[model samples]
Target: MQVNNDRLTLAVAKAPQIYLAGVIDADAPQRFESMMRSGKIANGSDIYLNASGADLHAGIALGRLFRQGSMVTHLGTQRRQRGAPAKPALCTDACVYAYLGGLYRWAPTGADRIGFPAQMAVDPKASADPDDTSAYLKEMDIDQSALAPLLTAAHADPAWLPADQLIAARIANNGRLPLTATYQVQNGEPYLTLAEVKRGGQHRMSLECRRDGVLFTAYNAVGAEHAKQIVAHGARSFVEVNHAESYPPQQDYATVQDDAVVIARTYPGAQLGSLISATTLGAWVRDRNSMLRYGFEFELGGLDHILRKYYQACWEYAPWQVAKKS
Candidate 1:
């Protein structure tokens, strides 16, 4: 059932993606659940929402259902045809609350928008129970301060949140959440550490300067059995730079600790000298016995600049004439 003013609809698209459009009402969550139970919505599907407003309570409920299903949320409407592109969409008012429910929420880009209506426009029931809204935000893992702009906007204007601000405030997690990188001094040596946790798993990669070369350490969370199999059967692991395999002649080995598989490899400075200008870095592991291969690739982008700073810091700390950095 849908409200008279706006008819909410759910449209299943290709595998791992679905479209949810129109206004939300008390029955919206029920409609979504019915589709989910009917196997129309696959696990961890990317749900594109084009909702304008909602019953505040119903939107909160729908958001909870999204989190429970481990879904990814984006801002887009259903395509016009089977293979047509999705139309950009806006999520405003109570609809914004529902978007927050996604485990991995993508920020609205370009013409897409996420906005909060002027105070006078908000539903009376929603404004009356500010506590409910506060509680919903907290439950969604959003900090109260993230909604400060929404709260302080002029009474006559809607508060529009940009893509960058949504990400910076942690209100919207672009793709699979932001990657965090930091520099830390360990054992009197400087190291560049980066980590990101998302739906698939956790990944931690670090770079440190060594006398002979740059040590790259990658620790990824894998199942206990898989980790054992990798260590016992001996897996072939390699590092890729810009889609090209660039490791030294030394074979890479894996160790299992803390339910994670870790590999440490040192690449000569001259070989990795172009790393700062490279486009991507990938860590790959292949089972020696079978065709199973798993890996993760990271785009350099901002990381390249970070690597430059790390190289300079390494030189300042332990100046060596030999080129020995990655």
Candidate 2:
């Protein structure tokens, strides 16, 4: 299911990116979904769009992209003919709705006069379910007042909002997610502050420590103590984080204490069997593998139990069998 008409087209490539141009249509969402499941466009890819808006139901497609956790960026290239004025592309109309789908958005720095149009108000029926729009606004951390003027259905050409307004509404992001964020932990564990936490990773896992609370990470620093608690008994259902690549730049492994589905990940993450020696586990966790093929997946546990044991057997330079947790 592909559409390559002059009005709208979707070009996907191995950079794992999508390029959208022209007007969006109702059926675009279905086609995009097919592309995602078929692995033509992997989930979490970034989107670069050049659209002045959409014909109809484009918001639905944009919302689906947003929920897929794909980042969105407005694309443009301005070249003035000698003595001519500059005309930058505006993500107006339903295009604004789609652009808002980016989890971490970006636009040319200092670029101005970009936003939705008065025509958005042309269809009162489009506002039929303010709840849906309201929900999206909340997720994007955008203000309701911001959308009122931008999405108004008046017949005039709308004045685009400036960067300050967009920044205040958090529509223009520079990659990092606000640590002032909040989320509910389903397992009744206390949520940890995300302050100073890095914001980008595909296979990040969410784990709960007996004393350390919840840690959602895709890197090596979930804390040495957190790793220890993971391999300890009773950690049956923790969430697992992966880098999505078999040989990601950074990695960690571990098994949950039990099996109510601990270490939940979108893909079957790597594991480090308990049968392996703690020394070998330590090398992997410490990233001492001499021939590690970048992007290849291995069976290391969610917390790298071997590293935890290695830390146990050698923490603080204590003697073997006399070290902490040994």
TM-score for predicted model 2 compared with the true structure: 0.45
Q: What is the lDDT of every predicted structure here?
A: 0.71, 0.44
CA shift of 13, model 2, Å: 13
TM-score of each: 0.56, 0.45
lDDT of 1 by residue, 16-124 (tens): 6666788887888898888778776656777787886648778888888888998888887756697987677888766887898898899887688777655422323
Among all candidates shown, the one with the greatest TM-score: 1
> Cα deviation in Å at residue 274, candidate 1?
2.8
Mind giving the per-residue lDDT tens digits that candidate 2 earns over 1-326?
22222222334322344666566777667777777777776555666555654543566466556557555454443333757754555566666777777766665444534665554333233344643555555655656665565545333466476665566556676554443322333454323222222233221222222222112332223344544543343322222124322222322344433221123222111122121222211111222333322111223333344345433322222232221232
Worst 10 residues of 1 by lDDT: 1-10
Q: How many backbone clashes does candidate 1 have?
A: 1
